[model samples]
Target: MQITASTVSLTVDDVAASQRFFTTHLGYVEQAAAEGFASLARSDAALDVVLLARGTEVLPADQRDRHASGLILAFTATGIEAEEERLRAEGVEITMPLREEPWGERLFQVTDPNGVIVQFVEWVTPSAPANA
Candidate 1:
């Protein structure tokens, strides 16, 4: 059996800004956009997002956290430090420092302007030294 992750849903407060961030920084292409929603695609992967304008919903502001916690979405990176530096150069906030974990993965965290946390990780794989 085989499984492939294709899409996920994210709630953002701004449509155009989020779209720009995703397309410009994350390399996602816009597949669709509407009054308050957009679907962006990244190569074979895609994200289904709904931009909820202020005062359009009836729920209290605090309740939004109910489903927003503990979701770790990781994007594999070639050089975690290099990626971190590039993002920092672009004026994006880096919430966590890059560090190698006990599991041997170099990982870091960044919170998007809309409050979504993105984790960047690169697996530790041994290979012949560059001099070889």
Candidate 2:
């Protein structure tokens, strides 16, 4: 099947809070919104996000009471250090400090108002293997 786009729908206690966090800090624009839902899009990327308020009718009755948890929404990025600095300058708290791994992944994270962990990662050349 050919996929035209990708979207992640999150059920949160406060849809507006997550919406604002994404738009204000992550360059997303509101595609649509209502009392209990919001759709966001970015012109530079295919990532689309939908926020549904807990207990909203849009969710199945059994799922309405559940909230999104234990999830990390990540973006593969370039110039991760610069982005981290920019976010810091904007007063966004960095929940995870910028760090690089041995296998060549650089990343950091920030928690949104509703506790969604937004992580940015950059892939780099790995260091020489210890046995190499």
Candidate 3:
């Protein structure tokens, strides 16, 4: 079987607080939510995510190793610069300014309030070869 997509699960300290930050700041729509868990999706992409409850036995026994660099999600965008500008204007903390990579990708990054880093990229040229 071929793998389709991947999902990254995050254990947040406060579900409602994080939910609001995602919905209001990042523009993610609530797909599902409860006291213990929540799922949200960005209106512009197929990316979906779920947030798990923290501070329980279900949580990892070791909390000292928790980190922000643990995960990085990359997304494709149509207008990289404009989107970055908009996000910056809205107070989005840009970790890395937009730059074109040697592989022809214009990309930038931002971190959510909970410290989840997301990278957004737009291709500079068509990359599709022959087989589709």
| Candidate with the greatest TM-score versus the true structure | 2
- lDDT tens digits, residue span 77-132, model 2: 89989999999999999999999899999999999898989999999998998899
Q: What lDDT tens digits, residue by residue, belong to model 1 across residues 1-132?
A: 676555655555665776677777777788877765667777644344444333334436764433433566578767779888988899888889898875668899877666667788888954556588
Quote the positional error of residue 70 for candidate 3 in Å: 1.7
Whole-model Cα lDDT of every candidate shown, in order: 0.68, 0.93, 0.75
Clashes of 1: 0
How do all the candidates rank in terms of lDDT, highest first? 2, 3, 1
Please give the lDDT score for candidate 3. Answer: 0.75
Estimated TM-score for each candidate:
0.71, 0.95, 0.74
